[model samples]
Target chain A: MRKKGLSLVTALSILSALVWLAGLAWVLQDQFFADNINRQAETLKPDTAQQQKEDSSGKTLQIAAIGDSLTRGTGDPDGKGYIGYLKEDLAKKTKKRIELTNSAIKGQTSVQLLKQIQQPQIKRQIKNADVILLTIGGNDLFRGGQALEELESKTINKTEDVYLSNLKAIYKKIRMLNKNGIIYHVGLYNPFSDMQDSKTTSSIVRKWNYDSANAAAAQPNIIYVPTFDLFELNVNDYLYSDHFHPNKQGYQLIGERTASLIHFREEDQK
Target chain B: MNKLVHNELLKLFRKKRLFVIILIIAALVPLFTYAQYQEVKTTREKLGNVDWRTQLQQEIVDTQNRLSSSRMQDDWRKYLKIRLAQQQYYLDHNINPQAPGAPTFMRVFVENSIDLLLPLLVMVVAADLVSSEASGGTIKLLLTRPVKRWRILLSKYLALILSVSFIVTASAVLSYAISGVVFGYGGWGMPLLTGFSTSGEELVTNTVHLIPQWQYILMEFGLVWFVCLVVGTLTFMLSVLLRSTAAVMGIMLAALIAGAILSNMVSSWESAKYLFMVNLSLTDYISGMATPIEGMSLGFSLIVLLVWAIGGLVVSFAVFTKKDVY
Candidate 1:
């Protein structure tokens, strides 16, 4: 019996050795010699397209947030930003499960965001979103506080024109992807509102917000949510140590406002 | 020669090292599967019923956010940049790089284990192959046989090869069988992208191509097998040199653990790439992860490991044939 067992084990080991040898040879053939094969043309069909269609009836509230650092929760110590707090608020208000996808990159400007939404996965996320939360124009206007230092109207005008056009394109793309999803375009706040040149920066920010709000108004199901007033009263308290981004209290206030808008809409729908 | 190899196999089996190795794999696979399952569950809970695309998208965004931070190390930034681009490529192709299934689990399991866990397991079997026989004074009886010394050594090496193959296959089968219970037994035909090469921080996709997951896993297992064989060969060499099995195991253990540590910090120490332990992660190249050191490619790692294995084999034969035995 022991001899028989030994033979059986030997046979199995020999067989696996041959199998691994073949695998090694195949690696050499596939990784090195397959360059002549036309590989770039083989496009993969989106596997999730059918899966997405099948699961829409479950009624989970899909919240897709996009754009710059604010949406990404940059200044908030918890890294939840307004969107995280907004998620918490909405969770408290609604019985439905809130599914949130924050595809926000810090320091992303409007042009970069326009490019980001063009990605297939981002497009798919937008398509499935029941409510879209957007925060942009901060990096375009602020340039990480660089704009505040220079305050050059000509350069700012150039940036704003490019930004407004990109914003219009982004809005058009989101609307095209999802006709019914409510777009809450979170407006920018003047971080330098308490500074010595508060008048110049405040007017620049207000004009930026007004123009962005106009763009939001032009699109269907898009609401321009104002955050200018939230930080305007106590800018120092709301601003993070960087003097640029919002602190936790500031993000919480923004979250509450966005959540309230979403909350009442959920109530109205019910 | 075949009968001699058969004799060596009998000895190896009698020791039950193969059985013990398989048992270890079987015991650990479920642990990893549970950990992986919990990770998937937590991600699902966080994202709420989203598809793998959203999960992958979130990862890409998170990497991008990390890259944007100024406080990150330069090499880390480069790694993230390359990974972000690769994730983007996977997203663009509509292929879910992490589709859930037994095959996917097996791939992840092997990829992670190739560098250290698998090598250590191979070490456990190989460390004592010749040293134990020498320490036990069985070398005198074995060498007293009429067979040529090289032939006997070759048979023992063949048996070691067979056992290495057995251990790798056991890991593959056990991980699949155990993880399949939780992750399901599908995704073999899932399409995946490969051939993503990095030039500095940039991901060069000109040569990128699509291959099914099964072929990808096969190729990766091939790389894993090669890595294990090289590590096994080095351990076998150590076994032949030292009379004490403990000494052989200790040296191999220290070198392997050091390799694991060095791969993390060796981005600045470029020449460290030539070490066999650093090259043991041959599977990483097949999967297109950033090389621990720049200029280390699949070809480079394969060549380095081959040279080391050949060197080990040469030393084992030379010293085993000429060494004085009491």
Candidate 2:
């Protein structure tokens, strides 16, 4: 009986070890044999027939917005950032049903956003968009207002160069994925216009916007929408309590300008 | 050899401490399940009338807000980024961010079980495995049996390994059974996605694996079992070196706790990654939780743990075979 028990114990130990080993192997297999779906260089062309039909029938106009906190609806008490208000504005202007898939995450910089756009879900959203809205470079430029306060022109210039290249890469990648969608790259506004170093901060923001707008102009079908003028006169009225993000009124002003731009081509078609 | 292992197993089971360990595990599961239930209640209340996508967006904003604060650490910021990416993934896919259920509770339990408490319990058994015999004068009787000292020590070590395996499995099983009663025995077939992020880098959201809940649990158990084996082996070595069970247990407990504390405190210190204590959390890497140190990969941690386990085994075997019994 004792001999039988000893063998039973040994067999059980071996069995348990084998089971655990098998589990470890199975889980590790995914890491070792990962699929190359993300790396595949295939571009998904937007279906023209569907677009033409939607254009004719005034069907749902799919809009995908990808970027940082400004695109994520932060600081607005209603939590509907510019994208939410943009959807409402677009819905009011056109008979087409507006379907907006906002894939913007808060605190994301240009490099992070570039990586986010590569995700399969975001790719799918981008593939189906009639218009792709973006709001980046805020985190890249502002860096939580620390850079604005310090006022290092050389450091700001260096950071802007890296951001512009990242922006260029982002625009290229987006166009590669969806060749026909109109890409509206939203320009930055001066959140520190009310601050002590408002003049220097404004100039730096203006230069960054100018370079970014020029980058947008270089790409076909990518339009750069300026917002510096919107907050130039009433920065406090538009900014939230946090002073970083826009309040509801601020997002409304942005939404109105974006809506007018979006409506321009459709009104031309009409 | 088998009889020696059998006898060691019998002696281990005869200890009341083993039963107390089971009792403690049994009691903790309900408390954790209740806490999970409370969390779900509060989340549901907080998210009332709001869609999951909107909720996820708000959660991302909250995380970002916390991250912007100067008090937050770099490790926490990295972890929040991964969490934000995960919530974004779920939002994009329209999957509800984890509602409290048996599977969710079990997943949390498994993730948290590998911490100091579980290792401490495993060490309790290991710290006494060899030392208890020496303290009780049973080593002389065992030596009189004609079996080689190496064989005798090997049997005790095997018994400790077996006990560690049982303890880990038992914890998993008990957590599931108890949580199943409260939340229902469902979600075994639900999909669980894990995303691994490189140290200090943005979360690689695209590299997610959608394994079933059962497979995730199995893999978690496997990872925890390896950690337990390392803890048990190291404690067994300490048991052999120190004749007093209390001394072995105290030292092992202190080391395990210190490892957990150090992993949290000195996560930025690159050399902390090489410490065996810091590498005990293999589940974090596999579950796609942010690693303590930047750049510490699953493979790197496994190597670190393997080196420690082997070194401990070699030291234990060498000392046991050569040391005088008297």
TM-score of chain B of each: 0.98, 0.94
lDDT of 1 by residue, B1-326 (tens): 99999999888888988889999999999999999999888988877655787788889999998888899888888888888888887787777777789999999999999989999999988999899999999999999989888898899899999989889899999999999999999999988777777888888877677788898888888888999999999999999999999999999999999999999888889899899888888777777889899998888889999999999999999999999889
What is the CAPRI rating of model 1's predicted complex?
medium
Residues B251-294 of candidate 2: C-alpha lDDT, one tens digit per residue: 88788888888887786588888888888877787667777777
Model 2 TM-score is 0.66
Q: For residues A209-244, what per-residue lDDT tens digits would candidate 1 score against the true structure?
A: 999989988988899999999999889999889998
Error of 1 at A188 (Å): 2.2
lDDT of 2 by residue, A3-42 (tens): 5754564566567776777777765665556674233112
Cα shift from native, residue B253, model 2 (Å): 1.2
Once fitted onto the true fold, the runs of candidate 2 whose alpha carbons sit more than 4 angstroms away are A1-15, A33-270, B50-53, B64-76, B94-99, B195-200, B205-207
Off by over 4 Å in 1: A36-41, A51-58, A91-93, A263-270
Chain B of candidate 2 vs. true chain B, TM: 0.94
lDDT of each: 0.88, 0.79
- The superposed Cα distance between candidate 1 and the true structure at residue A114, in angstroms, equals 0.7
